[model samples]
Target: MSEFTVSGRYKNRDGYRAFETTIDAVNEDVAREHVLSQLGSRHGVKRTEIELEEVGE
Candidate 1:
């Protein structure tokens, strides 16, 4: 299964919390794009304001 997820809170340093479920994928690029698209369009967040980081991980 392919899992794409996000975790973040507004205005909390990184301004969000996000992560993905465990899954295997042939190509990871498209999954990332999908996650980003969902976050921006569905959540009303701009792409520029979102930055992936290694905090909780």
Candidate 2:
């Protein structure tokens, strides 16, 4: 597994909210999916509403 620093934006009551989080995954694609799933479940945001900025170690 690798550690990834993922940054993105999600919809919020105020507007779009920026977020950054560390995730463990095999690659950047998986890291991105993880971020999407997490934010979707926690924040009730759709995949289209989430904008992925960067994914890096």
Candidate 3:
């Protein structure tokens, strides 16, 4: 696994909220999935509410 910095925006009750999170994954796809899963469960966000800005190691 590698360390990745993923930045994105998500919709909340108020509006859109920006987020930057670090994750360990094999690739960018996995990192994205991880972020989506976390945000969905933790923040009650839908997949369409999240927009990925950047993914970097």
What digit string (tens of lDDT, one per residue) describes model 1 on residues 1-57?
Answer: 455443433223555665443333434565555556766776677777666442221
TM-score of each: 0.50, 0.94, 0.95
Model 1 TM-score is 0.50
Candidate 2, residues 1-57, lDDT tens digits: the string is 999999979988899999999999999899999999999999998999999998889
Q: Which of candidates 1 and 3 reaches a greater lDDT? A: 3
Candidate 2, 26: how far from true, in Å? 0.5
Highest lDDT against the true fold, candidate? 3
Clashes of 1: 9
In candidate 3 the C-alpha lDDT for residue 24 amounts to 100
Which candidate order results from sorting by TM-score in descending order? Answer: 3, 2, 1
Inter-residue clash pairs, candidate 1: 6-18, 7-17, 7-18, 7-19, 8-16, 8-17, 8-18, 9-16, 9-17
Q: Is candidate 1 or candidate 2 better by lDDT?
A: 2
Cand. 3 Cα-lDDT: 0.95
- Which 10 residues in a row give candidate 3 its minimum summed lDDT? 8-17
